[model samples]
Each structure stands twice: as structure tokens, then as C-alpha cells.
Target: MTDRDRRNLLERRQRAAAEFVAWSDHHAQEQRHHEVLLAQLETHPDQLDGRNAMAQQRAWAQRDQHRRHLHDSALAQLRHAFR
Candidate 1:
């Protein structure tokens, strides 16, 4: 790729990395809030995707996985750009 194109890719990835960091921080806060809420509703857990804790945990796991996917995709693209 041309120098300008590489520079642009670098800039875009930098912004994406920064945004990812912010999203992670925000997600952590939201996770904590949900944890608290779950604790408060120990008897029910509010039917998140199901009627039990396992279902809710699975759903949350998927959400976390998606965040990881975003990070991984950015890293892979950055690696490809340098090649």
C-alpha cells in the first residue's frame, strides 16, 4: 500500500483502538451494574434470555465474546496492513 494509505489505516486503527478501550470501560461498568441487579434478584434473575442464572450468564458471555472479536479483528487487520 502507498504511504498515505498506510498512514490512513494506522490512524483509523488508532481511533478504533481508542474507541474499543472506551467501550470496554463502559461495558465493565454496565456489567457491574447487571451483577448488582442480578444479586438483588437472586430469586428470579429477571428472565434474561431464560428463567435462570445459566442463561443469563451465557448471554453475557456472548456479549463479552463480541467485544473480544472486535479487538481481534482490529489486530488482524493491522497485521495485514504491515505485510
Candidate 2:
């Protein structure tokens, strides 16, 4: 490859790496949030009334689903870039 082509490839790789890192950080944060939510549920079970508790549970489930999807997408992108 020519120098320019190599440089462009490097830039693309760098951008991909940065994106993966950012996604990973966000995923970690989400996981931490999930843990905190679980802890809160454990410690203050009475704090949420029946409907609110159900709502909180649903929201946590959605967050977990989204976190998993984002994690998988980021992994796929990183793998593609490496390959």
C-alpha cells in the first residue's frame, strides 16, 4: 500500500479503537448502574410501591437488554476492524 493509503487505514483503525473504548466505558457504566439499582432494591424494598416497583424492574430489564446489545455491537465492530 502507498503511504497515504497506510495512513488512512491507520486513522480508521484508531477511530474504531476509540469507538470501541467509548462503548466499553458506557457498557461498564451501565453495569455499575444496574448493580446500584439492584442494591437499592435489596436495601429499600419498601421504598417502591407495587406499581412503581414493577416499573423500576421493567426499566432495569430494558437497560440490561440495551447494554447487552451495545456490548455485542461494539465487540462485532472491533472484531471486524481487526480482521
Candidate 3:
């Protein structure tokens, strides 16, 4: 292959590697967030009652939505890396 082609291939490989790292980091952070939430619920079981439960549900739903968005972005990045 020509020098230019080799350089392009190297660049693409670098991009894919970077994307993999980014996705791994995002996944780790998401796991941490879940761990923290679980700890909170465990420590304060009373907060899961009645009105508080509804509020917690809404908050969790919002958080889950944001997390899903981030997860999708990560997936897209990884897909681009392979392409």
C-alpha cells in the first residue's frame, strides 16, 4: 500500500482504540452510579414508602433516561470506530 493509505489505516485504528476506551469508561461510571443508588436505597429503606417512593421512582426514571442516552452515544462511538 502507498504511504498515504498506511497513514489513513493507522489513523482509523487509533480512533477505534480511543472509542473503545471511552465506552469502557462510560460503562464503568454507569456501574458506579448504580452501586451508589443501591447503597442509598439499602441505607434508607424508609425512603421507599408511599409519596417518597413515587418521587424516588421519578428521579430514578430520569437518571435511567440520561444513562440510556449516554450508553447510546457510547455505542455509536464504538460503531463509528469500526467503520
Top TM-score prediction, candidate number: 2
The lDDT per prediction is 0.68, 0.85, 0.76
Per-residue lDDT of model 3, residues 1-83, tens digit only: 99998888789888878877887787788778878876766676786377776666677778878878887887777677566
lDDT of 3 at 9: 79
- Candidate 3 — which residues are off by over 4 angstroms? 45-48
Q: Write the per-residue lDDT of candidate 1 for residues 1-83, one digit (tens) a residue.
A: 99998899788778767766766686687678668656755666365635557765666677667767766775676566455
Query: For each candidate, what TM-score against the reference?
Result: 0.51, 0.79, 0.68
lDDT winner between candidates 1 and 2: 2
Task: Name the lDDT value of residue 64 in candidate 1.
Answer: 67
Better of 1 and 3 by TM-score: 3
**Candidate order, lDDT descending:** 2, 3, 1
Candidate with maximal lDDT: 2
Candidate 2 lDDT tens digits, 5-72: 88888987998989988997898899899999898776765874777777778989999999989988
- Pairs clashing in candidate 1? none
Of candidate 2, the 10-residue stretch with the lowest lDDT total is: 40-49
Worst 10 residues of 1 by lDDT: 43-52
Error of 2 at 16 (Å): 1.2
lDDT of 2: 0.85
